[model samples]
Target: MKQIVIIMIIASMLLFTSAAATILPPPDLETQGILLTTDVSALGIFSNNADLSWRHSSEVLDANLNLVDIVWDPETGLPVVDPETGELIEIWELQPEPPLKYDSASFEVQMATVYSEDTSAQYGEIAYSKNSMVDTKALPASMSNVENDRIITYTGLNGNRILSKENLMLSGAGTPGVPSALSTTCAQCIPPGCTCYPAFCSFVDTGSKIDMSIVSATTSGEVRNLNKIGGGDGERWPPIPSVDGPAHMSYSIRVAELSSSQPSVGYVSTYLNLENSEAGAWCVGIPSLMQELSINERKSVDGYVSLFSNLVNYESAICR
Candidate 1:
């Protein structure tokens, strides 16, 4: 009787050990987060509010001066009439009298988030940088001739002949030109005898944020057995075990437009799922799991124009 009891005890012990070996625990969870911000400001001419002016030395020319007579179609010196407005078409008008010291100006502001990702790997990598990730574009007012307008000719004080011409008749009298990294090689570098133009856009500012969390588990049936032992009470175990290894979140902001006609604004949001492999566990075989990440971004810019003296002042507000 004693021998039979011993044999039965050993068999029971073997069964219990086998059951424990077959049980697997849950996996681990890891997370990472990121945020970004940016700002931009600029000054430049506003086309809609532009004005024309003429000057000779410090003297302002008279708008009604009979400097010259011009006919758009010389063959038909007869003045043409605008069919839409029924007004005599004036081909050339004298530049603004008193030579407008200043005209229309504008201001703008901008902001954005920026980032990049590599998708070739199973658990892809994410990255961001000032030099590589972010980009900006803006438009500046260029020298333009007044349409259909021309200067004829005038006699100078010494009887020397002076020809009235579009560009030669006037010049931009706003802030002196400043060097630009985009247009020139150096900050102050300018071509000899050439005047620099004031930049339409200036200076970019940036910022960011981050948040993270992590959890871990093992591959073991004992975890499930513990739930059973606790009378099917799921709460007794770490919230459902995860088979995946870890997860990470990344954010990127981009300043898409600094000068486009379209509203200078942009926003983006997305969720990504990734795969990872796990090493074989004593209780459970090797397996693959899915990881997840979330992203959000935004950007915007506003422009304003103001006149001081005879020049236009350009300004902008940016947010990201």
Candidate 2:
């Protein structure tokens, strides 16, 4: 009976251990909670936002392809007008559909600071510095302190504890799940000096509840930069869509121009990165568990998510 009782006790202990193993400890929860609180809430906005911008670019390209040389009146040097309508047919009007996105889709990706200056980057020396595009300059005076409009975390009184204002342009900049490993040989690294040019729609979705009725994110806290690299103060694109401070990211998405125009939305279900060889590379997209959402958008590159804009137009609120 004693031996039977001891065996029963051992079996119960084993069961208890297995159950406890499945539980997450508080410290780790606290650590990971920041990511859930912050990036998780905005996943839809990022993925869908990129999808919308992609559609916008496609529309612009279509317009450019169809455009013909304007017949300008030699006397007035102005674009000739329609004789029947008596109104000038603007370049945009000539397009089959109204241009829904910005004209340019180029952005500055700072990875190689030691090399070229233009949007073109040098091999092995990718530009590594980013800048601010959605500072208060993009916000109306009345919207001050409306924290949801941009990505920023406060410290002391107004000091943003996370990334500085200049780094605002780098949302989804680097691969989220890529590990931070260096290459000793050129063959082991990505083809260096790769430049990404992205375009945006005119209407930048502020991601505030007022803009598109988005869920509020905990925009302030420490984010893990597990895969940090690049030049000047080092660049960071973590293993997930996360940052180490509070921020409100603004995105370029086309809203309803007419009843016929549909709202653009995409569900980001996976992350894909191909560096080095297939041994350590990851090129898979993870589907989200949420109810079905349309895959309306992807990045300029096949699965890249960061929207690269060349020009940062404060007036247009275009963050490249």
Rate residue 147 of model 1 by lDDT: 19
lDDT per model, in order? 0.18, 0.18
TM-score, per-candidate, Cα-based:
0.15, 0.17
**Candidate 2 TM-score versus the reference:** 0.17
lDDT of 2 at 319: 14
lDDT of 1 at 288: 18
List model 2 lDDT by residue over 201-222, tens digit each: 1111111111111111111111
The TM-score measured for candidate 1 stands at: 0.15
Cα lDDT tens digits, model 1, 165-263, are: 111111111111222222233222333312232211111111111110100100000001000111122332122211111111122222222123322
lDDT of 2 at 161: 14
Worst 10 residues of 2 by lDDT: 5-14
> Where does candidate 2 stray beyond 4 Å?
1-71, 74-90, 94-136, 139-145, 148-192, 198-320
